[model samples]
Target: MSKAYNETVALSQSGALAALRAAVEKAQEMGVPQCIFIVDPSGETIASLRMDGAKYLSMHTARAKARTAASIRNATGSMTPEFAVAAGIASNGGVTNLPGGLPIRFGGKLAGAIGVGSGTGDQDIEVGRAALAAIEADPI
Candidate 1:
């Protein structure tokens, strides 16, 4: 028998940091405090940050949003209610239906995800999008 291996890309610390900075900048621009979380392709945390005055609960929510994005391989906000029910994502632990989560892609492959919290859903999503744009410029 022959054995084969699967190769996949993962987010690097530098990339995560860049994304985090972008997210923070966006949050600042929007006049909102935030908690940002980034995870690897395997749904492992790479880096996280909580801006001053950010809600304490946002810390856990941000990580959960990142985990959800990594697990579903899609933006958490994009998951429809029906899809969430069909996929049982609504019942999954550490998975959120929040709008802050965004999947990170590299070379057309899923590399990881980023999540932002402590702002309104739309604001959080905006921060996530900014983070994604920064990450796209320096894909790891």
Candidate 2:
């Protein structure tokens, strides 16, 4: 049977919040505050949180990271320097090559994306890993 479309799992608001909570917990454990952002499969913001002491502007990057991950359906920050800059410029900063962005995959489907910021890139990625773990998301 040929189908016109395929139904897929989508990330809900509760899942987004759970990811945000896990990211926050990881940041706290690492002694760094963070701005955690989660976006739906279509790259719309679903939930977010900025821990105290996190850099305020990091929220912007967090959004960018989330959008980028959702858009590409993969982790952010693998782009080369030139492409990263060009993509940023072309997308008008809608996407970014930040290391903290990871696609939230579930049941072999793309569910959503999470973005973390306000710490070192390594720390941000670490926090994001914790989030994915909390949700039992498939690895990217």
Candidate 3:
């Protein structure tokens, strides 16, 4: 038997680092200490940063949120109640129903995801969006 495969794109390490830096800068601008996480489409960590004074719990939550976005290929907070329940089971508790996670796309493909924590949900989402904007401006 033969198997077929299709090409896929993933966020490069440099791209992930750039996104992390952008999130950090955004957090600083907002005067909010935060934990920022970037992960590949497979939910593997590419880069992460925990700002000074960020809550320890944010470390775990940030990564979980990124994984949730990557796994679902959508913003974590956009999931419907039923989809959230299903995603939670499918991700084995790695999914987070939070507003700070966003799927990263490049060249019309799912590249990765970014998540921010240790701030209000809206602030976190802002930081994540800033990161995505940075990545878009300087692609890898």
lDDT of 2 by residue, 57-91 (tens): 99999999998998888899899999999999998
Models sorted by lDDT, best on top: 2, 3, 1
Candidate number of the best TM-score: 2
lDDT of each candidate versus the true structure: 0.83, 0.88, 0.83
How many angstroms is residue 64 displaced in model 3 relative to the true structure, after the best TM-score fit?
A: 1.1
**Candidate 1 local lDDT, 1-140, one digit each (tens):** 53222234777889899999999999999999999999987779999999998999999889988988888777887767877555545456477787888888876677888888999989898899899888783232
Compared with the true structure, model 3 gives a TM-score of 0.85
User: For every model shown, what is its TM-score relative to the native structure?
Assistant: 0.83, 0.92, 0.85
Residues 1-140 of candidate 3: C-alpha lDDT, one tens digit per residue: 53221224777888888888888988999999999989887888889989999999999889989988777777878778887787778867688797788888876578888888999899998899999999893231
Leading candidate by lDDT = 2
How far in Å is the alpha carbon of 74 misplaced in model 1?
Answer: 0.3
Lowest lDDT sum, 10 consecutive residues, model 3, at 1-10
Give the C-alpha miss distance for residue 78 in model 3, angstroms. Answer: 2.1
